[model samples]
Target: MEVHAHTHTPRKKWTHYFWEFLMLFLAVFCGFLAEYQLEHKIEKDKEKQYIHGLLEDLHEDTGTLSETINEFDGHLKRNDTLIKLLTSDAIKEHGSDLYYLGRRASRSVRLALHDFTIQQMKSSGGFRLIRNQKVSKAIIEYYNRTVFIDYLNGIESNESDEYRKMAIDIFHPVTFNGIVNPDNTIARPENNPPLLTYDSKTLLRLAGMVSYIRNTKQGLMKAEIEMKMAAIELIQLIKAEYHLN
Candidate 1:
């Protein structure tokens, strides 16, 4: 019988086993670190994009606010003139001025905020990207003004509507139709227009309506100024914090 020699493989050393475990652990740790870094970079990129969009929105808001404010100014001045024409004793002689001022007074404007970035951030849960406490707070404050001013705008609309109704109550249909050209431009009658009513009470009631509209516009204009200031501060703060031009 041929005797086969018993050959046994040497057992792995304890240190060898430990080294193998260590290598695997290191590979997993490195992979975790790499993934974490990539996620961080992606978040940072998203943050940059959000800030850029917000900046654009804020600038547009500032411009719109400024223009709206000027429009309110014009509307208020014309309303004041309309009140004078309405209440004046010599109402028959003031037809041209009456038609011009009355038509202008009925016109109204409201602020349309440029809030696309803020809307996106709210919808997308992106407020987390605004890591700076000051920036976050300013953004909140600026948007809050929009909500408050919207309430004031509601009041403005109601007052303007009343004023317009008063106009229809007092002015003759022909005079009303004469003032508005086909293209909606004012065309004062060459002949002095006639009033449907000459009662003192009726004229005073219309004047009172004008006063209410003016009061609402006063509040709206003040709120707009405040919001515009907030927008400017927010813009500066964001630009400084992000080192953006």
Candidate 2:
């Protein structure tokens, strides 16, 4: 019987293990770098999209603000005319003019704020996407001012309610409606109705309403003017920053 000695395989050298570890580390590091680059690109694209949308909103707000300013200016003039007529004795003789002016005097100018992009930024926590600090701050301030302006507008609405109540006492509703056309233009009533007749008591009430309106008009003017200025400033800033035409 012959016994053969078992030969054991040689162990791997330390250099071999080291090379294996180095290859694994390099592969993992390269994969991490690739993933980081991809995420960075995606974030950049998202930021541009947000900026473009914000620009559109700003443009719309600017245009609307211009129109609002014109509308409010017209209302202001009407308010002034109504105040003068209601405070003086002339309103008693020319009461027909009051019928035409009452509705215009109480008309509130509503602001059309284009806030869709800003709302999205707030809800999505995407404000950080705007890398420009000035742009971000301007955007925040513009929206914040809108809240105050809206509060002022609510005051105008309350004043309008009061004006309407006073009008009910001073003007005949059927006669007033007759003067206003369906398209909101002034037209003589179909029946060629007589002018509205009011007593001293109604005149006193109308005089008080005129005083309230005179005081309220100043506040409305202040708020509307400030909002318009703010919108213009923000529009300019956004256009400059984004290089928009």
Give the poorly placed runs of model 1, Cα more than 4 Å off: 1-6, 181-189
Per residue, candidate 2 scores C-alpha lDDT tens digits across 19-138 of: 999999999999999999999888888888888887788778778877877776776676677777766765555565666677566766677778888888889988888888998898
Candidate 1 local Cα displacement, residue 170, angstroms: 0.7
lDDT of 1 at 208: 90
> Lowest-lDDT window of 10 residues in candidate 2?
188-197
Give per-candidate clash totals: 0, 0
Report how far off residue 234 is in candidate 2 (Å): 2.7
lDDT top scorer: 1
TM-score, structure 1 vs. true: 0.91
Against the hidden reference, what TM-scores do the models get? 0.91, 0.84
Q: On residues 105-209, what C-alpha lDDT tens digit does candidate 1 reach at each position?
A: 656678898888889999999989888889999899889887878897788788778887888877776778766878887776667777778889988998898
